[model samples]
Target: MKWKANTLSLRSLLCMPLTLIMLSTSITSAVIPVKTAYGEAAVDEQQVRTARSYQATLSDWKRWAADHAYALQTIQPESWSSNGGSIGQDKFSDLDILIPLLADKRIVYLGENSHGVAEFNLVKTRLIQYMHQTLGFNIVAFESGLGDAALGQGRIKKTATPDTMRRSIFGVWWTEEAKPLFEYMKETHKSESPLRLTGFDIQVQSPLFQNANWIPSIKLKDRALQAEQEVHKWRMSKDQSGFRKAKPELIKVYEELLQAVTKNENALKMDYPDEPHIVKLMKRALEDRIRVIQEFNELCIQSNLLTEQGDYSGAQSMMEWRDRAMASNLAWLVTEVYPEENIIVWGHNGHISKAQSLISTMPKSMGELMPKELQQESYVMGLFMGEGQAAENTREPIQLNPIIPGSMEDILAAVGQPYTFMDLRYRENERGNSWMFERMIASYQVQMPMPLELRRHFDGVLLIKQAKMPTYLPDTHK
Candidate 1:
């Protein structure tokens, strides 16, 4: 395949708003320069400049950590070169440090720099295993669709295969790095305490797993699903105008489906007389299916184009709506669905941060809008990369600039561990900790250059030294 470049300077791209910049576009220069998987490729250092423009080095960060006596927890590798580790002995004994910090917590929010960073996903999978085994966190909730999760969860209940588990979650997590997590989920299904799968997003993460077709009223449900499958015929669409033209008519099908669902609500309740919760779940899922089609107009492009080309208002509304819905769905999961069970949430740094409104134009994020009681029991960890490259959705890898000096990431790197986790909770008002209170470089590689205050948002952070693109699995859905 030819290297596709969007023909824009990295500098110019960074100048754009985070909302617009995150809409994945080709950023390669087309001039070929191949590099190893785990090592940094040669990219212009000037392209990595932040607003601060500080001339600093790894030595400076080390000097700062030495001054502070900064304590760091080094995480052991589960062996990156191959999945298997020293089978008998404990490879992840380092994870014991997280126990005291998380043992008493009800929820753990794992934030990645982006959806496609393989290193983040790899460690997160281990963390999930550790948390599940040690801390009694039985549920692994993704930032996927509520309805899809509902259906996926049902499938796992029936037959928990690796494919079934992978299919239940988002495609971004469908990789060789993520294969262990999928297999683990399958393995634990027959155990006494299996990891439960769920999602909180209003958006559709997996097109393959759907549940709206199984509604109580099959005739009404099939009609809507038929219209939806018809919309998939435009999957190869290159014409934006065609989608825009048909959006209204396609939306009408869902709108009618929603109306019919509401009208027959009581009758649906009658069908599941002994199981009100199941009835409620299917009803809410039907609503989710309707809302998702409208959000993207049965297309992922619609979500990305929300902010592109003078569509700022559309983008803002969609962002606020998604965060709010995610919050509500998560709250429901904790209180209603998985009551008394601890949960681990996996999502992007933007959606998982508590200080989202403080840093961005967002009114509230999923972290902020979560019920106050549930929020009290939650701890959010913002994961970051000190160096290396990330390819969003397995596209051309964009090399990250060095960690911006005086930023949170820079300060964390000050600790000088190759892969480490630092607890930012319960620190007294002090000097070395002052970095958390300042607005800093959270995602120089992902989006939002130095826009968030760490202490105000994250309770902890997992900093990996380098990031590499994931080995994306074959397009099995195709």
Candidate 2:
């Protein structure tokens, strides 16, 4: 069989041994010459079935689009790069279709299989701009530290520099492809209605990094900070023994910090009688932050233990805990932080998909745990590539296998457009039932097969037929 020049022959990569990369690094480390995120769990080889052919003819697609109700006429060749370009006139205009589809939705999630793809960064950047200008989606919550994003947004108000954006989000996004979005965010601050940025993660290690004020006790905070530093040091050193030693110490100190904050609520209110409300919310935020550190550390310990016992899937299943905590934090942001505003969530497809997890026994995902209102008001669009080089932030780019037969990528590849979108929300047609409910390949990284029911997972899907190596920015500040 003839193979595409760009497609690599590494289908056996996943069949090799599995290794968890990092525990405390900002990005979740999967493992390899290239480890991946979107839950760094290992899968059984038998469970990872071969890609099947889902390719359909043009007429067949017409019927599917007619049933799904929309097949966006995407502009060919980097139409998403136009500056302030409007619909029907510019390349970015194809994105305007998203405005209507997302209308009346309270939250919108844009997901990526790999964070290191250049096209994903650029397209999502353009989407953020379009949504902000036309749809009034002023908030963009990333998968960064809650406090890190808060600090970054504050700096955006002050400088709005690209460096600040790099520091605020995960390390995976620190690339030239991702820089334009930060610049756009900077420009927004100068506008009448600035786009706001925040993180929906519980990964912030220090309470002091948050907007939270009136935190209790200097002694406890100092000790917790010191412990966190040690844990971070050990993690970065890749010294497992050091990490194991430092982790428990940090956990102990953090638990004390949580206890101290909980105990001081009454005292803080009494001390600051005039600012009771701010004190309460701020103090509660401190508790929330403490819980984040506690939960992450606990998950790491459990994962390490499970790995030692050879329970690889169970070790990965621990991500369900992390995602649940993140969902709770995101829900808090919606309820208490931006109750009236429309929210745009940037995260991994694994976290954003409303469908059950195909890798984990727990099955539920962050989208499933999102606010109950999200069932009716949320739209998630997953991103994928047919074939080309895909990069992970921590490693060099890898050549993805050519579009596998019977995969969602194969069906999407048949669309003929270099760039295209398919709305999965509508399923009014009875024809083409196999591709509808059939599980198909939608790998997280390196062409690894992890199939799922197409329509059940995403409201829509955006496909970039090829990926290029992302131009990496300098190492991040954090």
Candidate 3:
């Protein structure tokens, strides 16, 4: 057959091994040097073969997916209430399919592309409910302020009203989509065995972080209180310029306060015998906050010093420090607070991946760290969208581009499902192709180097054909 000038010869294509062809297709850019009559020129052989092979493989995969993809009816009836309400047995039958996969896993991570997607948050709520009711998951964690989350957990344990629980939560979680989750948690908290809520981030300005004065005045001396107030004042200013200048001072004083608290932990517990459990929990949570703040402070210091020295890798290390702190806090929560309970973690996909992305320079994420630390069964599920609008860190709208060809997104979108789920763990065997284990391409506002291997990084994927932003809670812009 005649081939186009830009295409590869059939003989040349047939000469290459399928493994090499698959590897070339997985790359972000692949160029084959053609021996032209005059000089060498790059041809799109790799891209062509990748597209063709992927198309054929995807056609077969879809046939398989049709049988495997869980139907919406299995998850919930079409007439089911979107509002926070009790789900019936029929609705749970869909989630029951996941029970075997989750049976041995202690930590289940559900990740989203953006924080503002209403549908994603709603689905997360549903899955969380199923996991709680069916799989016996008791702890729910977020990439939020640990102090604030701990305070919210306390309120829920006390059987506080929904309004109180909402107020106790950090504003980042104050979206209309998040309302049902709070409602469900509030209702569940009144049960004989209640669920727990916690966070694992370094944000210090959350309401609970600002109001961390419950640690007895005797234990926290006047000097430490004054230092904390000073840091709080700077944080409230919201002036990045001023905060950068004062950050070093803030770190110094915060470290001093942490030291004081560490020294007086025994005395504080002894002084409050009746509320020992509460006091101990609060102490541990506060210590987590301190560790996170210390990490952030070190990041800032290292970044500045590195910038001055013209070494940028320090900035990347700063990012890694934050993730490490998150991982540490998560480990602490499982080991100290709820050793016997199964925990569900919610966060952006980046933080929950088990492998490094070709695009990111940071070290392994909390998802990677946690499983290794616990040496227990853990699973990660990443969410993707074919096309839609997403919010940036600054709350600006960004239109998502179409699915990239040869990527997992394109493969799943072609399945002709509005929503679909794929268990990546067993996809390799199902597809009978090692290519299925390769990195799955994704799109980002800032270009990424390459995609991450789907099978290695994620246990499962939840794909949405179209996505839209959720309604933000009042005065909570980001």
Candidate 4:
């Protein structure tokens, strides 16, 4: 029940002095009165200093935006100018608005709850639009693995196969930026595109609807399943005999779930402060998850060396489950696994931040993972949506005609012309649509190029706050 990490304890020790000073001098303290806010007449000086420092960072972005508003407008949607009959590249100095925040590329860290944060949603939409339109990137690999397959693929011309993904609905309310991207694809590349979506996250199977798993594989797996079925029947059946028979299977699930939850609990407690009661229930649900994994692994293990593709029945499942099993250590893997001039991953903010999630065990900052050469070779940036700007007020979203490497010229061409958006805060039926607001916020552009020390692994960070600023063109070249 006591949630604490030794590392966190160490961090507190290092920050305590500054924290104390910040607490004493914080504006909040003065405005609220020391006694009223802290129940003390005097506050620690370090607390005040720490609070002030945090306040500055929290608003640093907005401050930066306001200071460069004129420059920002200049880097609008139609800012690019063509040199007649020659290489048409936009000037970089004129369009510094698209630089990303968080220059450290090593962490490739994004921190935000996936279920919320429209800002994250906007970023994703912009990235998808950019990659597909400009770079000719035709593949979209999702963390949701197999379940993502249900979403569909983008289009590709001259071929019966489609390369686009289906219109997705989950996690949309919070990830409002995603709506525009899908809508754009639907409208533009309704028939042709090659940006196929593939999810290696989990095997696709259904229990209620009867997926291939209708028949269990191994004897143990079958027993485990039979026991489950028996329990289900007992729960629904009109006989007491079945109830007694189902108890064992239910107990088995309870046992497995408890173990898994305990393992996860011990892992989560170091940072998250939620109650322990949830751990008990989490364990019970984990049984089904464990069974799915077990079956998938078994299938993989039992297959012959030259097994047919169809033999892999339970390989695809839920996106989250598959991602958890297959996703490598991100920082290490990004740097060492894929060998490309530049690799960009589109994921929720949570996966991209240094803060904890499904990936890391420690607070691994981006600076630590970046290789020196990459810092010299690439311009790393993260694209995030601004807090209140809309995509239109920002600019028209368009795919970079050719996904050119990150350069001052490319940035210039992308910034093209200035655009305007009206404030809809007072409008009807508007406030509930966070996606719209996210698209609006995604309008403002902040580019954070990877710092010299942390730029090797990536080129730059581009964050899109408003979803619509980037033109939503379908992958028409399928």
Which one wins on TM-score? 3
Which residues of candidate 2, in runs, are more than 4 Å off? Answer: 1-92, 204-224, 231-285, 358-363, 444-446, 476-478
Model 1 lDDT tens row, 399-469: 77877666666666766677766666644444334555565567722745756767788888778877787
Using TM-score, rank the candidates from best to worst: 3, 2, 1, 4
Over 151-219, each residue of candidate 3 has an lDDT whose tens digit, in order, gives 666545344344433534555456677767776776664464445677777655444333444345544
Would you give me the overall lDDT of model 4?
0.32
In model 2, state the lDDT of residue 36. 60
Task: Give the alpha carbon lDDT tens digit for every residue of 251-342 in model 4.
Answer: 66546435544555554332222222223322322343344434433333333222344543333222223344434322233444333313
62, model 2: CA deviation in Å?
A: 7.8
Candidate 3 off by > 4 Å: 1-54, 74-86, 157-170, 207-277, 289-295, 304-312, 357-360, 371-376, 427-435, 444-449, 476-478
lDDT-based ranking, best first? 1, 2, 3, 4
Roughly what TM-score does model 4 have, to 2 decimal places? 0.34
Clashes per candidate, residues 3 or more apart or on different chains:
1, 6, 0, 111
Q: Residue 290: error of model 2 in Å?
A: 2.3
* Residue 300 of model 2, lDDT score: 65
* Model 2: per-residue Cα lDDT at residue 272: 33
Give the TM-score comparing model 2 with the true structure, all chains together: 0.72
Each prediction's whole-model lDDT (CA) = 0.64, 0.64, 0.62, 0.32
- Which model is ahead, 1 or 4, in terms of TM-score? 1
lDDT of 2 by residue, 1-478 (tens): 1111222233334233222232543544333332467656555333223453434343465445434333435322232223332222244455645644675677999998887788888878877766776667878999876656665665564553665766578778877887777776766555555677877776643334222233465666567566656544442342445555655566677566556656776754553332223333444444554564445555565566667778766456557776887788788878787888888999988788886665545447888888777666888888887788878667477888787765677666666667668766644334453465565567644466676777778888888887876888777344
